[model samples]
Target: MRKWLTGAVLGYFLYGLFVYWYIYMGGPDSIPEQFKGTSADPGTFMNSRELLLSGEYSRLRNFMYFITVPYEWFILLNVLLTGLSRKMEQWSDSIAKPDFLKTSIYLFWLSLIVTVCVLPVEWINYRISLSYQITTQSTTGWMKDQVIDFWVNFLLMALLVSVLFWLIRKYQKRWWLIAWTLSIPFSLFLMFIQPVVIDPLYNDFYPLENKELEEKILALADKADIPAEHVYEVNMSEKTNALNAYVTGIGSNSRIVLWDTTLNRLKEDEILFIMAHEMGHYVMKHIYVGIAGYLLLTLAGLYAIDKLSSAVIRNWGSILKIDSKKQIAALPLILILIGALTFASDPLTNTVSRYQEKSADMYAIQLTNNKEAAVSSFQELSKAGLSQVHPPFLIKLFRYSHPTILERILYLEEYHAEEQLKESQD
Candidate 1:
């Protein structure tokens, strides 16, 4: 068992390494001096594999334009990668099952259905991710992510499948309930721990420097009617050369993380814009909303499990040891419930996230005291990332959190004009 596990792990590792090096060796002249200031360049790149490393904006534009066409170029790569990764994940799930045939059959049929109906839907979703402000995913790089993503998911999926299957065997009849009940605490633990625990596996993160910038940022916080004394930046370029910034946790643990790419690439104005955006999420208490949503959904899911698993209880209720109020072997039940909930909430979760991101966008523009800068900040982000400028609406509804890159730029442009008019009149 151990050797098999090791071999499986090694297979995934080698696959990922091959994919990464293939793309890396093929990538452009390294991002020349990010974050010292905005790029001397402006425009977009084409998405063909040939231009993956050119780093010219027109090429980027051509790329984004291609992606946007037929529902954006991003859909092809993202959806392909996601499918690949998910299958790799389910590979271990199949391995752990006593009825490997049943698991494989179910997964295959589902993937088939997903291919027919969900593929377009998924394509729309993934296409929308590229419809953001900033990115650098080339056709090849994007394809690489599809590969790396599968390997990552495979690791966790393996762990979950093994653990959950083990619990089901031990519990028997009321196994489903046991699984779900156990999953509640397990998920909760991940919610708090992930910001520290699992995240570091992919990238390096550490404290920020330049006490003066930190102090200035803190003072800016005071101006925004909030109090924050410190911030931390993480090295995101190490993993995949992506740019990102976010505020995670609450109270003492609540610290802002700026990706080195973002920190190194953005100007003071752009940095301020990004920080303000994160601050908007904080001020609006979106994290609280997310946690509250998850907790409520969990309880609802558990109630559902109790009702659904009654038959299992009736048949194998004795071995299960579940009663009106108490349960001894509840792990199996918990796993089933959580699993179902996770799948069910995919759309709802995206909807909520979209709202949160929109709010943050608006707040950042307002708090920064200039709509034009907000526009420019997003533009720089889009340029550096070589993002898709537009996305199909179908994808936006099911998958996206933020407004599309084109949508944001348009909004910022209109807002910029409106603000300028107001100032002129004043």
Candidate 2:
């Protein structure tokens, strides 16, 4: 077991090295020429010094994105292989009377173990962001957020673990099907409460403070036939310099939220364009579609987990100290399988997301009739976020949910030209 773990670590290290070299270090030294001067002066989008910094930041972030998956897998595998999970399960059983209580206790220990193991990586990522001037958050503030995140995750996982084990024990063979059925409403519930409950835990949210801007945004929303009374803004500038806006939640809880950073950094027209793009998601019922897609994926994932967990227990139960799939000690094994499956599915999921984002971009441009705003907004976003205008193919495939900034800008230019030609012909 140790040998297997060691071999996996070595393999992932080599993979990380290859990814850093090929995808990170091998990218273009500067922004592509075609992407420049569309929204601003030739060098205004990203000056030479900024370009170098962005490159270094992007490379580190992309490398981390690829390597984190394997690191997570190693953590879980190590816990399972080292008999820590078994020992934790035994301790939980000795302390708790009921099965549910025991499961919760065991899960808490497992969660803490994994969270601690992953903290250094998280801290390093945060420190990198700080060094790049991407985030202004202090180390103390960041650590506080981590604590909040840990507790929040544990509470949610406790509920989920409780339900999951209940399903597992009650319907051994068909538990995955039942769990998947339950996840539909559970998923929606989370989305519904996210805007009101989950979000406020992370950042302070209030109505958009700029009454004039809020009025314009609401006018845009009304034109889209959205019954929105207010646009929301979050205090993101306190944490990060990155600009962002998004539509979140469903039904009555749905809201449009702009980061204060976006509000401060972008022009009125650009902000309107961003809002319109978010509204596109609402108008097209993308949220519902996303929920359905997620549930379907969950159904498949749970089914795979069921099968894979059984196979692992059968093959290496003695070595891993896990006797059955239903045993609490098997949670690490299940997590490892889920992590692997999620990593494998990233490209498929990201492709679908990119398509939806591109569709939204089209909707925003058509609705606003402001091609320049759309193009400039994309450019500003890239500048603020230090995002790669043209990321490597593998990174784009797995990590990117939206079309790259360069792609979006070029698409807008093409659409504008076509529109102008149509007008001239008419």
- TM-score on alpha carbons, each prediction: 0.55, 0.96
Off by over 4 Å in 2: 26-44
lDDT of 1 by residue, 32-127 (tens): 343223222223323343133333332334333323332322222232223432344356355654543433343344334334543454444444
* For model 2, the run of ten residues with the poorest summed lDDT: 34-43
Candidate with best lDDT = 2
The best candidate by TM-score is: 2
